[model samples]
Target: MRTGLLLTTLALGLSTTALPASAETLHLFGPFKDEHGATAPIKGSASAMLDTTKNTLTYRFEDNGLSGPVTAAHLHGPAADGQDAGVLAPIDGPYTTRMTGTLQLTPEQVKEVQAGQSYINLHTEKYPDGEARAQLTTDLTGHKHHME
Candidate 1:
């Protein structure tokens, strides 16, 4: 009886181990090049910690080189260059050069963001409307995502 109990426990443990691990973090990098009026386009990197279980994303951005003060920043819907869409989260920045924020996403928001339906953009004083932008898409193509 004891042997059977031990085997049962071992089987349960093995089954649990086979469960897929949740994705807790995502590293995203791309360039932000907009000739519309940017200082000359800048490259930036972003890292996000996603609480997939909770549907939240905390991200940080580092714009290695850029000019002028940031006027506005936001996470937008997934779309290519010259495409327009609504905002996902309003980043609390336009501060200094680098920006970071912890954003809580609703179920629908999480679904969209995970589906490669989100991008980030920064507006500068010189380009009050918006000068730099980067769209996030699946890396299945093995091509580096770019910020345009």
Candidate 2:
């Protein structure tokens, strides 16, 4: 349950009145844990590079222990931590460690990401709902947070 986080944000338009229309980049990261919270402790980490200039969200993942092979991976969103939302995009995978890829993001999706409303979920047969869940954040550090 080590929670060490470093969050740095470089956004073109930080103004409340306007959405960024210029170059923006977000270095976001977080750790993966059992979706049911403390029911089963899995280990992993995920990182993301959201570049508005390219309209792409590049995500990378590291898996330590999972109940089973990943059945699916996705960027689920428009919700806050501990909440559930529909998949905003599917992460391509034969899923293995260092799972990383770039995904095109809509303007609205970018907004969701910037607002801390999106998360990455890795699904497996043992837990079809989600085996690894990382509430994506601007944090550059922090691998796992244990339930208190």
Candidate 3:
């Protein structure tokens, strides 16, 4: 547990030499599930470091057992759980099993992300709508919201 916490701290650019409560970063993460009407044999994970100060979100994402190669990836939201919304940002990718990129969040996007109203959606040939999806629901740093 200590190791995990320390690793998370380091990953988020937090240093012990910094002042207490200096969390300008938020870690948003979750695993992909076949819920939200997705109907493919996909499983995966998504994680991101949201630097609120810069309104930039750096993402680390991976997926496995997808029905087909990824056709598109996006950050979709401003919607509630079990609800579907339009894409807010395109996820940069090699569009394979693993991908990473950075997104410059608009003010509205930042607000929505902070409110847990955002999700990662990977579209595939088998399911052009979506293969599997994951919601970025909380700040692991405990600086803001908590995942349920």
- Tell me the tens digit of each residue's lDDT in model 1 across 1-148: 9999999999999988865587455544444556455667476655455566667777766664556777788887755545756888888754756666788888787776776667677777777666677655445244344322
lDDT by residue (tens digit), candidate 2, 1-148: 1232222222332443355557788887778867854365567777788987667898888866787788999999999888899999999878886677899989899889988899999888878888788877885554453221
What's the TM-score of every candidate structure?
Answer: 0.66, 0.77, 0.74
User: Which 10 consecutive residues of model 1 have the lowest summed lDDT?
Assistant: 139-148
**Candidate 2 TM-score, true structure as reference:** 0.77
lDDT value, residue 21 of candidate 2: 57
Question: Which residue runs does candidate 3 get wrong by more than 4 Å?
Answer: 1-23, 35-38, 139-148
What TM-score quantifies how close candidate 1 is to the native fold?
Answer: 0.66
User: Which stretches of model 1 miss by more than 4 angstroms?
Assistant: 1-27, 35-39, 64-67, 138-148
